[model samples]
Target: MSVFPIRFLTLAVIAFHSNSFAASGQEQQLFLLIRQLDTLDTLVQSTPRFEAPESNARYRFDYPRLTQDIQHIRQGVKDYLSPSRAQPRDPNELVGDYRLDAAHAEPWP
Candidate 1:
């Protein structure tokens, strides 16, 4: 029998092993991301409660909503890292627009 078959088999095994190693490294990085997300959630919670000065600006930052969105992201990541089953993806999307129309205040100058 020709040695070509044996050489091909060895190469295939090496390729498979390399792919597995790469996947393992990627998973580790994702796990680290989950930890960082936890830290971010803590920081968001610790933020002091205060109201912004009223203004006629068209839009204002919605901090509370933003915090909610962050928590949503954290949960999504956690689920991805440890899914219970192949469940359907969430239908709702992130309300990335953190700006809310300023309460009807004095008109712009």
Candidate 2:
């Protein structure tokens, strides 16, 4: 009937397809990162230099450089995998109540 309905339908289809594409891309990226992590884990396990004393290597080295590398990689992975907190909020919710002098402030939007 109306052009508005057709436009709305078109937009809905585009949104659905875009969401599917984005989701698949995210899944692929996550799988690749996990694979890389698994490979790193294997290397870490195979390294005699990275071993602990009670496992038991008589006297373990502090290995500060290796520790720093591990920390940096771990932090990078954590940051990459972490969800962003800057999400859109409901516009109706007001952030500040400073303007009490007004008869009313329409909802934040």
> Scored by Cα lDDT, where does model 1 land?
0.55
TM-score of 2: 0.31
Tens-place lDDT digits, model 1, residues 70-90: 567657767877899996598
Candidate 2 lDDT by residue in tens digits, 4-109? 3224333433443354446668655554544554454444434454232343223333233333444454444455566466443333332212222122222221
Best by lDDT: 1
After superposition, candidate 1 runs with Cα above 4 Å error: 1-21, 54-58, 104-109
Deviation from truth (RMSD, Å), model 2: 24.8
Model 1: pairs clashing at backbone N, Cα or C within 3 Å: none
